[model samples]
Target: MTNYVGSCLCGAVTFEIEAEFESFYLCHCKHCQKDTGSAFAANLFSQTGKLIWCSGEDNISSFTLAGSQHQKSFCKDCGTALPNNHSSGILVVPAGCLDTDVAVIPTAHIFMSSKASWESNVVNIRKLEGLPE
Candidate 1:
């Protein structure tokens, strides 16, 4: 297993995760788009308990969206989104926050049905209307 480090945009919050590099995904769900204010969200998933908050734990803010099981975490200073625990106990880390070079390529597009029509197709990746099969 490799150790990875990450921090929020304002450097207020930092964390480390001991995990194996794995494939990522681009989610186009409406909630993701609104939460990120982007066409989609890039996410890296890893097992729970491997993630450790190295600094600024008090600066991390969390919000539990209505009707959703996931709680979103962000830097209280800069509002930069950070990793959060999923109901399944996995850590869903935003790809852009990682400090190490990521080796995994995105394997599939989730919630593609909600993806913007203007977005170009990802070459060679499996495109699914919802989650990967």
Candidate 2:
């Protein structure tokens, strides 16, 4: 019965997810990289979660890859990723979209074969709190 609240970057859309996430995954699929414009996508999956759109529901947009099962939901204004409930009854939530922290750590990194070459050994890179001088 846990409730997780979230909103888009522009605050144009808000929502709530009620249920414990079964797993959190860092997906490195090419489709994920293209959609997120990043090395990987952090996502939470829940089989029985309930989604409640609290505001600006009409501002939400979704896209499904024509030849694949890949799909994504976002806010039309700022294009922040949002939760999507698939036809198979699974709920997918972008971890970054949550307003509060989630207790579950990422369960695994998936589709590693498609992981970007430059993304390798990223942990060895120097950490910076902000842009380097």
Candidate 3:
């Protein structure tokens, strides 16, 4: 397993994950769009229990949306979003936040039904109307 290290934009929070590259997905869900302020969110899904907060855990802030089961984590100082664990027992890491190069590229696009109208289409990906099962 490769060791991947990442930090918030302000360097106030740092974390590490010891795992091999897993699947990557692009989520275009409305909640993710608004939370990231982007057309979509690129996520690297890996097995849970491989992530470790090396430092600055106190600087990490969490927000759980109303009626949503997922909790998003970010750096309190720089607002850099961090990886979060879901109730399903998976670690969802933002691909953009990784300091190391991921071996696998995004293989699918999720929530295509809510994709931004102005967003450019990506080629060669399996587009799903909603989250892939």
Candidate 4:
């Protein structure tokens, strides 16, 4: 069994999750894009019982889109996404905040019909380890 650690950008919130993640999804839904302020959201799914908050649990905040099941949790101090527990017994973890390696790669891109026009053809852009010169 493996364990993964994660933290908010300001380190104000930290957590651990048992390495029971089963699937990875790159969601392109409008809610995901807006919540992440990016092209998509990388989410790891597991049972809700797998998550354990190591510290600063009080700093976490959650939001839900009106009239939808779309929900997100984050650190109120640094605005880094945290895990969310769904009533369906599922846990959604933001891949960006995870400090450990994701052994399982994302199997597919989902909700592409809602993807932004600027999100495609990314193979043409210059990649970088940090910032550009």
Candidate 5:
């Protein structure tokens, strides 16, 4: 029964999700790493959520990998990831795109076998509030 609002980095696409997320996952699949250009993709999944496009819906584009369930939706302007409402009735929303603070934490890290080799002992890495001087 939680509602979440999100927009793209360029503010070209906006949407609202009206349902509680069933799970949150940090995905380390190669496809996710390549699309996000990061160690993993933080995603929130909901089976019954409804996606409401608030603005700039035309700016949203989607791509589904051939022969795979892997799909990505993004803002065509800034390339920021957005929600993917799959035909299978699962809605996958990128956690980073939400403007609202999420109460749900990651439920698990998936595809660990494909986790980046450089991510070893990442918890021990130095924490900085800003870019190094």
Candidate 6:
């Protein structure tokens, strides 16, 4: 199995994933949207991957919504999403945090019924390298 390295936004937390991700998913569940503050969360799933904290372990924090299975781990300093184990014992890594290339692309968008109305048309938006005037 290939191991991948990742880090938090502020570089305050570094970690490794030991195993190839079985699949990737874009979740549009309401909880996912709120947790990421975006249309959805791109998460890699691997039941066999072992999460290893390479550095700055103390800078990591996690939160689970009360009475819900929704949970997220992040860097306390920069609020960047980090990897965490799902309750189902699957390793869930936010795809964006990885500095290494992920060969596998997202399989599908789950919970699409809950997706935001403005989210689907993003592909049609004008591409820009920076904020538009």
lDDT of 5 by residue, 1-133 (tens): 9888999998878888897999999999999999999999999999999999999999989999999989999999999999989867899999999999999989999999999999978899999999999
In candidate 4, what are the lDDT values of residues 68-103, reduced to their tens digit?
Answer: 999889999999999988757798989999999889
User: Which has the better TM-score: candidate 1, or candidate 4?
Assistant: 4
Best lDDT among the predictions, by candidate number: 2
lDDT values, one for every candidate: 0.83, 0.95, 0.84, 0.88, 0.93, 0.91
Which tens-of-lDDT digit does each residue in 1-133 have in candidate 6?
9889999888889988888888999999999999889999999989899999999999988999999988899998999999999898989999999988999988998999999999878999889899888
- Sort every candidate by lDDT, greatest first: 2, 5, 6, 4, 3, 1
Q: What's the C-alpha lDDT at position 38 in model 6?
A: 94
Per-model clash counts, in order, read: 0, 0, 0, 0, 0, 0
**CA deviation > 4 Å runs, candidate 1:** 120-133
TM-score (all chains, Cα) for each model:
0.83, 0.97, 0.84, 0.94, 0.97, 0.94
* Candidate 6 off by > 4 Å: none
Clashing pairs in 2: none
lDDT: the better of candidates 4 and 6: 6
Model 1, 5-93: lDDT tens digits are: 99988898999988864658889988888889888889988774388999999998888888876567899899888888877778888
Candidate 5 weakest lDDT stretch, 10 residues: 84-93
lDDT winner between candidates 5 and 6? 5
Against the true structure, candidate 4 reaches a TM-score of 0.94
Write the number of the candidate with greater lDDT, choosing between 2 and 3. 2
46 Cα displacement, candidate 5 (Å): 0.5
Answer with 1 or 2, whichever has the higher TM-score.
2
Per-residue error at 49 for model 1, in Å?
5.6
The per-residue C-alpha lDDT of model 1 at residue 129 equals 94
User: Candidate 3 regions off by >4 Å?
Assistant: 121-133
